[model samples]
Target: MIYYQWGYYLTKQQILDLYKTWGGKFGRFNPHDLTDIFHARRSIFHYLMPGPVRVWIAGNDAGDGVLFFVGKPNCPIRESVEPDLAERCLAMFGGPPCPFTLVPNTGGEAYIMKRKGKLYKMDLIQFMQSDTKGDQYPLSLDEILPEQMHLLGL
Candidate 1:
């Protein structure tokens, strides 16, 4: 099975605010029921009440805050839910920044970033694999935006 996961990195306060605002709407089991899950300094994953689309929030290794949202490939949630949530977060918390996705089993990876008020999408593996240099693959992530670097856990 192929799974597509993507999210934005956020600050701790932002995560908390998100939980407070949207947690209740997640259906049946309140993610808040898990005591201290959000408060912990380390990474944590809180699986929200499941439905047609599965959603969860987890702290990134960087520990700045958390990486949120993940959905299956071709899931309508990507078009319907993700953009709306991203826009809301961007308006409320300053960014819907560094949106990225890694599709397991498919070698698919990409990130969307804002530069000079314009958004650009870059396909990492594709760029790295490009034959621009006589079979010499790109040796670094230097070409990638700073916000996008974290997607590789760098």
Candidate 2:
């Protein structure tokens, strides 16, 4: 069971707003998404996030945190978040608009392509360490009580 966390620097309020608007439902790739090279490779990439919301204190106690959810809602698969930590992670884009993308298994881990056909990739470790302000590790399920796991639909 592979799970992914799409990292984003969003406020706590913004997170709540997203839940209210999207009903906690995250996004999946659509046909139009293929134009983006990063998204074009995988049709079901978003399904990788199936764990609880992983949060890391970033710059402040509240309002700022490196937060993201796991897999898709009602996902039948279950896996400890530990292995994902050891697995490859997401990378921040150098340009504006889309700031992040999943680091591919081979080649450069970070990528950016210009409208004019230019493309680039960056070091995965450096990006995660510096761009994120600090390393953000995945949250583990072992700490959660078995009875409460269902609340997260895990």
Candidate 3:
């Protein structure tokens, strides 16, 4: 039948790179392209593994989350998504013995807004962390003024 299906999918490296704040405008950009890349399968993954599964769309905040199902029933997960479902999907994929898959979000802008639901965005982890941390490690250099450096060690 050639049915076309597209949903939330991202490589672990893409997720990791976004976590590093390589993206912009709500951390929206391809993670793999960034120099900061984490090695993974580069493909073969979904928040909830495809197959009689449920997919949810969550924002960066706690109370702001929604759900969306992607399997047979095609419903949503509405209880503040935990790894429980992901674990279940893992089990379905042949347990821990089964191999893993990796895929990147590329740029959240395009996919993040797909059929809004009540759950955290896959990139939420990175978005919040970057705001607090500011992408890379904050240089202590900024903490000390130009004159303060020579005086302290001088």
Order the candidate numbers by lDDT, best to worst: 1, 2, 3
Residue-by-residue lDDT tens digits, candidate 3, 12-118? 34345433442212212334332222111111223244333322223333232222222322123322223565465444333321111112444432123233333
Residue 132 of candidate 2: its Cα lDDT?
Answer: 24
Reference-based TM-score, model 3: 0.20
Identify the leading candidate in terms of lDDT.
1
lDDT of 2 by residue, 21-52 (tens): 43332222222221221121111123223323
Determine which window of 10 residues in candidate 3 has minimal summed lDDT. Answer: 35-44
Greater-lDDT candidate between 2 and 3? 2
TM-scores, all models, native as reference: 0.30, 0.24, 0.20
TM-score winner between candidates 2 and 3: 2
lDDT-superior candidate, 1 or 2: 1
Model 1 lDDT, full chain set: 0.37
- Per-residue lDDT, model 2, residue 120, is 29
* TM-score, candidate number 2: 0.24
Q: Note each model's CA RMSD in angstroms.
A: 16.5, 15.7, 15.4
In terms of TM-score, the best-performing candidate is 1
Error of 3 at 68 (Å): 11
